[model samples]
Target: MTLLHMSINAHDPQRVSEFLARILGGEALPFPPFPDCWIAFAGSDDGTAIEVYPLTHQLVAGVDQVECRVGGERAEPTFAHIALATPMPADEVITRAGDEGWPARTCNRGPFQCVEIWIEDRLLIEVLDPKMRADYRAGMTVRNWRAMFGMNTQ
Candidate 1:
């Protein structure tokens, strides 16, 4: 099956959900099975979803960890890596994110344009391919930069 949304556990999901909802087109979702809260955005009727899991309460005290996604891959994002849309212009995304207290960066990654963010922690997000992003915004396909970091591009 296709990859689903990324999950993050937070203490104030309501606030976080509201933020994501406005910035990333996500909507708060029900979270009963887990002890934490959740928010999600399924880009379209037929596509992948991005899930946010806020840890209302930790499984054990002193355990504070949030998931991570780098270059379209999921892992324990030591940084608050967020996925963003394209065609929004890298400059605009960075400015907006910074204004919201979430720092963002941009670069032309080969054929894929990218924007990385750092909010609360070191977040890495991207706004890619102008053409595809417009299409994805229209529900044609996914609209985030396929983040790539390396000696060649970071």
Candidate 2:
């Protein structure tokens, strides 16, 4: 099974986390460096964690800004990021996301023309395509197909 959480570095960790939380309906989280708050959602403890921290990097491609600043080395986030799914319908999720200042756009990537996310140089998320889910289920149960190349169930 795929792991559950992904982390990212944030110039304003609280703001970035809250930005994600609003769309995902996550709980407010306490930020590090004291007296600040971040945001996160609750899920089964699938053994994963996300850590957001501050850095300094000038806006390139002009999508980011210094909403707040913590002076130090201008460390650009060159590591992991996260993708969050909405329980709400995709259209509603898109609309609500725009309303909450997450500029979202959709594209297709991966097998069978899957729907994917390009959330502003953040995480690349594939919105669960119903067809893909069904296909996955079918593939798992089809033993003749599954056993072809040493995938035989014990």
Candidate 3:
């Protein structure tokens, strides 16, 4: 089965959609059926996209609570982050993200390396190289992440 897209909540859907399009090599197209929402295609041909919805938009209200939040204690059922495979070099992508004012960091664990970037300091997107994903599929864990990422899980 092919994956088409995934929807994400954002305080400013337009801003977030534009950022995703630039980073992942795509375009932000509006959804005519709903105003203030967009589809950010990572690759139009591949049909991979992020459905960006405004947190406070008409469609979102009354369905559930929506609020913008920075990194901190996350409650259960919260969307932690979204991972997308990219052919671009991790360092270059991270640099571009940082230059654009997004907090980006390199995460290298052993031979595996990827870039984690937060869009507007609210959404986390992990851009992974093919090599890194291969290694992960072979069996890698958070144990390796602590050393490379300096994570405070302990």
Query: Which of the numbered candidates is closest to the native, going by highest lDDT?
Result: 3
29-75 per-residue lDDT for model 3 (tens digits) = 66444566766776433445676765543221111222233343434
Off by over 4 Å in 2: 1-74, 112-154
Q: What is the model-wide C-alpha lDDT for candidate 2? A: 0.42
Badly placed stretches (over 4 Å) of model 3 are 1-78, 108-112, 140-154
Residues 68-123, candidate 1: write the lDDT tens digits. 22232233433223444544666777788889987556544333345655555444
| Alpha-carbon lDDT, every model | 0.44, 0.42, 0.58
Worst lDDT run of 10 residues, candidate 2, spans: 58-67
- Could you tell me the lDDT of residue 13 within candidate 2? 78
> Which run of 10 residues does model 3 get worst, by summed lDDT?
58-67
> Which candidate has the highest TM-score of all?
3
The predictions' CA RMSDs to the true structure, in order, are 12.8, 13.2, 14.8
Q: Which pairs of residues have clashing backbones in candidate 3?
A: none
Ranked by TM-score, the better of candidates 1 and 3 is 3
- Report the C-alpha lDDT of model 2 over 56-152, residue by residue, as the tens digit: 4222222332123445576442334443433445556556556656555443322222223435544344343345433333342223223533444
Ranking by TM-score: 3, 1, 2
Q: lDDT, candidate 2, residue 135?
A: 37
